[model samples]
Target: MSGSGIGHDQWKTRFGFMLAAMGSAVGLGNIWRFSYVAGESGGATFLLIYLFFVLIIGIPLLLTEFSIGKAGQMDAVGSFKRLAPNTKWHLTGLMGVIGGILILSFYSVVSGWTLFYLYQYVTGAYWTEPDGGFGAAFEAWTSNPVAPLFWQALFLGLTILIVMRGIKKGIEKANNLLMPALAILLIFMAVYGLTLDGASEGLAFLFTPDWSMLTEPSVYFMALGQAFFSLSIGICGMLTYSSYLKAKDRLPAATVGIGLMDTVFALIAGVMIFTAVFSYGVEPDSGPPLVFIILPSIFEGMPAGHIVGIVFFVLLTMAAFSSALSLLELPVAYVHRTLGLTRKAATLIMGSIIFVLGIAASLGFGVWSHIQINGNNILDMMDNITANVILPLGGLLMAIFVGWYLNRNQAINNSEIESPILQKVWYNIVRFLVPVVMIVILFISLFDI
Candidate 1:
């Protein structure tokens, strides 16, 4: 079963398959970004809209990516070329490859913070009662570019090592344990959080809809963007992951599983964060400050603070690694499939390149402040380019490819199951709604409020 033959193969089991897919979908994007996006928008109202878009837009996009990749049986670049045949549509896959590498260059830097903080938790650094120590520690480290660079390299190396170990032995095995641990840790956090005095208020904020937020044009656009990013659509991870998937598996079922799992992570992270933040009476809109500054300070007072903080960051670190593993795999899979490089050689080259480029992203807080573009730091620029630009544009291009270019119904019929009506509805949504939604959101993201 484990024989190597250019060895492009499916996941070993349904459990392994679920862990890999869910691991890709659940990440820092769910914990930090989802809470911030929800907090920045009108909380529950935005979440509801985001969920709606996730069903209509995210699900179809996920299906298209899976079906296309399964059809091509190759990574992003190779797969696009196979499906499109001699046109520039393949470049969309190139954009996805580049975007994955570029995004992870900064993403790993942030992930390092979780790992760093976890060590601090074990060492009791965050629980020290010095005034402003929490923010001060984060600020001082980031202000020194070399510290973040070192940590980013550490995180990158860890991910590369796992990928080099082969899918089942390394990636699947680690995530199987880590994903369950993360979910359990989150449940513990939520239960602990509910005991705090402000828990009820936070729940209200998270669950109650503030429909008037819909009156603003940007709110809708923000919801769409969050939905897209949260579900990991147009990232090439899904496309690449599915290319290696078993041909006989149902694409729609896998997409649904991924979507639901992604949503679960976000909701659970919300509970974990709200409990801590509202308990401290901290403002939710403190932006990135909430995670680094507030959480540390809150941890100072909690019983068994060090142990809890350690577990929390462990959850974060696992989430980060799982997502990073998928992203790094995209280009390596492409190289192996197209240029015929060994997986090891491809991983080393791609990982090394990403490590070097990542220094600039790590430096953004201090030495590279002058290098800002559009008043955004290196991280912001990378995220905006990937999230607001490449992804939606990728999604738009994918919509065109799947809807106009591919015989999507045949694609659907090939993997068809019991629900012909649902299949037809999915086809229609991908055909009409997703492209329309992407266009509107892209327009708003480009020029509007």
Candidate 2:
């Protein structure tokens, strides 16, 4: 196979590539979404199942994406095209590019919310709660129509600036800094949270399992979905990142590192958030409002609450920003590779278009609140379509392409699995197990079953 004509920018080191991949995997899905989903899904029971899925399913798929990218050495779409010339396999990569763009559009809007809260904490503005408290304050701000747009633009602009600088200097350097800061802040908060009065209850809630809930099929489905989404698999972000790696870099070790870090981060976030919630006597299953609404109220009453609030939002924003970099990079890489644009030009054009698209989602909370698709607002609809439909389908096709269609010897070589026994285990899981699970997830998500 011939290389894509565009010059490839490689990761300066294996450590840099691992951090970038972990940054892509460890985002709002782990911190913000994971908390609420676990709360509603039966806490420790869901965590057990989620761990099962991550090990049995997530790591295998992660390795699959890494193998494809390292082997093809191109942008997501270009990789498939180069690997399987004249076939429709590239469509899977195209779907990933589109999914990345759409996910970033709505994703930036929420990330902007984190920035808003962070700013409020820094300025001490949150100390003086609005008339009805943080809940009302959250509602009023989201419904303002204009305020959210500014934050969204600012957040997306930051992402564009980082990605525009190219791989090593921009994306890798930023992750090296942001990810460590995020980890420290998270660990500090979790430790502090454990010292609170309700720490015991929070631990119980998170660690105690309701084994009977295992009988409910939805628990398995939610775990499967969370495992897939949290790792940022099927979006081509991993594929694009891994393409920068040298052939000597170990794919299996990197996959394990990214997966382990992401899962451990989510568990710590759960401990941090839940201990605080239980301490303040707030409802654990507060749904989406838990972060923006409920947390502020709880913080207001805590000792040195203002400082803690600032740290929490900072952690949240860093997590979101790190992930957003990968999301934006996926499309930027595509445009640069396939369209023959310079990296700067592709970043500018794609970043600008995504910012414009995100305005609709920002407005959805306010001016466009009445507009609904299948009972979901614009932002929710975009998230549902991409997360529930596009990502799963992309993942399914990727599994089939790599597991069944790609040359077996090439796949094995790309995976870098030295042991024949381990190689067979990974291969059969990707070939047999992943496809079956993905189909079940698609069925459950589509029919709302």
Clashes of 1: 0
TM values, all candidates: 0.95, 0.96
lDDT of 2 by residue, 196-291 (tens): 998889889889999999877788777776887899998788999989888788899889989999999999999988888898898888776689
Give the winner by lDDT: 2
Evaluate model 2: give its TM-score. Answer: 0.96
Please list all clashing residue pairs in model 2, or write none if there are none: none
Candidate 1 wrongly placed segments (more than 4 Å): 1-5, 414-417
> Among all windows of ten consecutive residues in candidate 1, which has the lowest summed lDDT?
1-10
**Poorly placed runs, candidate 2 (over 4 Å):** 1-5, 373-375, 444-448
* Steric overlap count per candidate: 0, 0
